[model samples]
Target: MALSRQNQSFRIPCQQCPLREITHLRDFTADELEFVSRFKKGELVVEAGSTILVEGAHSAHLFTMLSGWAFRYKTLEDGRRQILNYLMPGDLVGLQGSIMGEMQHSVEALSPVILCVFERERLLTLYNLHPSLAFDITWIAAQEERILDEHLLSIGRRNALERAAYLIAFIFERGRRLELFDERRFIPLTQQHIADTLGLSIVHTNKTLKKLSSKGLLRWQERGCEILDPEGLLEVAGWTGLGEGKRPFV
Candidate 1:
């Protein structure tokens, strides 16, 4: 069946669905969901290779992914682009501007995406009215901060192989937590995006990617970057899944 759009709340009946499983909405009550039920949403699932929201567009709506992946990126004046983060299902993208008023980065669909959008006005009201909702938003912001810290470390500290390995392991663990891991396949992130995320040139990124593939640690085939031996690379990167300074999620 198609997703329900009757009210601000949307219901996808397939509870065991991978994306649904990752969603953190279980803690929210039905009454607490009223504000979202009235939201104006996109009719079609935004396809991969499309812009979800442009940078500095007076972003008056906050988004929650009902399904699929997206990424946040920004371009510098010299035309150097950097992917700030890869956002999966259940991740909140626009909450950073709840107080600031506009997004600093552009958000684009990384895969076919279904989004639940709540207007800025309504979200502000809901945040003020429901402490739980506000707390959830706060937690999402903290998670973004954690990711930024790691991305900085990947660029500053790790070599190309280690940088790539850290990113692979990071996404792998996240996918595992949501039970979204596909042992036969890895996430379909683009080489260019990975290069930007790791702050490496595409040429260098390709060489490092080929090295990893040749080592049987991963396979960056036409389909996507598949992990052949996650353990091997994990040991090389020394990723503990803990934060740089403190325990993760502290």
Candidate 2:
């Protein structure tokens, strides 16, 4: 028997999952993998521009991003929406909602996305039966925290140029780590998205991006921006890059 969502069948085996093959990811033990296999409820395929989670809503399922890009955002009372962060493969969603009472932010898919679903009520089983999995959960949360901190720093303190550089470099490096970065790959983000993330006006964002493009640091494609000189972006951002690490993808 199989469960379904959104006119698609949900099926992915943990044993032969492709994410396990990512070089930076730690290999899961057989038992841990087995547990995770059973822990998964199904998969959900979300179309671009679809809202996957809503702010202040009760979430019934948690998700691990199998593929594609999404962003977490919060809308103020006056209707200004601030993009909190962009989410990518192997990132967890609804983690806070699974623990807390209601979701504090909304997630909107930027591209067609595949997400592995888990029963939110059973999340405690992973924590109680598998200490290592619980630790991985903690690690993921801390990683997200660091990203949020950096984003806040960029928006609150960094100048427009530095902010733009940091954002492009940051997205490039994360995509590069996932082996998904290339000239041919569409970034699935628009200038509007960048403006929202940086808290800049659309015109200001375009001007800043043009400066990077003129300097040969990046190029704007039809629907995406290309990282031509990642090193140059890094230099402008004053960022060293994400340090060496082993990440757990399950």
Candidate 3:
């Protein structure tokens, strides 16, 4: 996924999708758009396992998720990786570094991912030229913080089955928001990744998944997961979107 001159024109398909309509680009002036368009058409946006920003590194650029998923992670001394957070379309990676020059966590693509990036100098110029851009960036940061809090609650208190159910429900709603998914379609994460995130063993994760299927929650397919009973799944997950004790599906 290294960006070379040969495949320069390859852009991520999700960049121009209809789902982007919900994302406001009011801060992008004609000049800003023109500058961004040059990088937009290049393959620099999508990369597999590419480190967008490393922990404790001088942060020079900010990334916007256009397609695929990414994680903010830190490796423990014993070599175990703690999954700090998961990101989706419209989410900004390492915005906290915009003011401070260093990143606290490393950001890597969870899959082949597409991102929109702006260098720190360029972003500062844009902010000075357009106060609206600064406002938008602040708003997006707040939303990201709220999401992290919700994930903390889910991973900390919920049981294995409930965690699985909560994750499924959250993914469904997120996909729907981005116009990238349907209830009949399956999610693409493997059981191993889910196990790691949910703090369960692979065997337990598989058993829990099978139990959900037997209970008529959904059908798990090779490519993704489908919700057979969206209502039932919601109940099992104990979802209360946008509340103080919310289940993190909003």
> lDDT of all the models against the reference?
0.69, 0.86, 0.66
| TM-score of every candidate relative to the true structure | 0.83, 0.95, 0.77
Using lDDT as the measure, which candidate wins?
2
Off by over 4 Å in 2: 1-9, 183-185
Candidate 3 C-alpha lDDT tens digits along 115-223: 6655666776656765655666776677778777877888898887888898877766666555566445566666766776777788998999999999999888764
Among all windows of 10 consecutive residues in model 3, the one with the lowest summed lDDT is 241-250
Candidate 1, run of 10 with poorest lDDT? 241-250
Off by over 4 Å in 1: 1-20, 23-26, 33-44, 242-250
**lDDT accuracy of residue 183 in candidate 3:** 41
Question: What's the true lDDT of residue 152 in model 2?
Answer: 90
Error at 187, model 2, angstroms: 1.9
Report how far residue 27 has shifted in candidate 2, in Å.
2.2
Per-residue CA lDDT of model 2 for 1-250, tens digit only, reads: 0122442254777787777878877878988999999998778888888889989999888899988899999998998889999998889999989999789999998888888888898888899999999999999999999999998988888899999999988888888888776565446689999998999999999999999999988779766877778899999998898877888765
